[model samples]
Target: MKKIINEMKVRLPSHSENEAVARTVVSAFSALIDPTVEELSDLRCAVSEAVTNCIVHAYRDLPEGEFGYIYISLRLYDNREITVEISDNGCGIEDIKRAREPFFTTSESDERCGMGFLVMESFTDRVSVKSKVGKGTSVLLRKIFSPHTSEEE
Candidate 1:
């Protein structure tokens, strides 16, 4: 059986500022579960990558100054499992497998290192990516809390 403790959905323009917005929302939502500082940091970093990818890669087709929207959903389970889903309606990844490979970035001119997926995977217990060319991409992240850091006994 699955019990949901809390859930929230946030939508924002795919801009740099909103990246912080997503991270803040996730951090605040996570605070309720008393995650360790490391866990919190990892969560924030993963969120940053996901949001950045939406902003940088997803809306590449849009004319300059025109931006798309990013949807972020967060769910907290009774068992202290946190799930974050970030989606973009911008250009989708044509090669999900190659994209997930470390250092595989399309934005070389922007100095992108292409480690977004790798970082997300490292921080979260599980990460899933779904994308369709010209449709969009959705990233789902899951992390289970274990009391081990300073924030927890």
Candidate 2:
């Protein structure tokens, strides 16, 4: 079992405004490894996409003013590995495989590019999803920081 270096769990309202909140918290938590600017930017973008999914898709059915909650957890492990989990307890996804395909948005509008999973996968070493209809979905993302990567090569 890998020991945890540090961790935090937060429950935020699934609101468009909280996207920035999530990004801020993620940036601060990820600073421990002193990741390169590019690496940090990638992580932030991935988090944004995940959070937006929770707000846009998961809670889509909520009465206009009503809102669901988004759960976010950040963990740092002993081996320079960081894991971020974003979850929601709202209407869940019906299909995981098809939803992951590029340009596959369920939204009727053109706003959603259907690239959330791809973005997360591109920015992290691993990305996993779990969902149950009416039970919501959770996206887990893992990244291993390597500042010397450029120097070593």
Q: Model 2 Cα displacement at 85 (Å)? A: 0.5
Q: How close is every model to the real structure, measured as TM-score?
A: 0.95, 0.93
Query: By summed lDDT, which 10 consecutive residues of candidate 2 come out lowest?
Result: 144-153
Error at 142, model 1, angstroms: 0.4
Reference-based lDDT, residue 106, model 1: 97
What is the lDDT for 56 in model 2? 89
In order of listing, the candidates' clash counts read 0, 0
Across 10-78, the per-residue lDDT of candidate 2 in tens digits comes to 999988999999999999998887788888899999999999999989999899899999999999987
Supply the TM-score for candidate 1.
0.95
C-alpha-based local distance difference test score of model 1: 0.93
Mark the regions of model 2 whose C-alpha exceeds 4 Å error after superposition: 147-153
User: lDDT per residue, candidate 1, 1-153, as tens digits?
Assistant: 769999999999988999889999999999998888889999999999999999989998899999999999999998889999999998999999999999999996697999999999999999999999999999999999885345435
TM-score for candidate 2, please give it: 0.93
- Residue pairs in candidate 2 whose N, alpha carbon or C atoms collide under 3 angstroms: none
Provide C-alpha RMSD values for all models, in order: 1.8, 2.3
The candidate that achieves the highest TM-score relative to the unseen native structure? 1
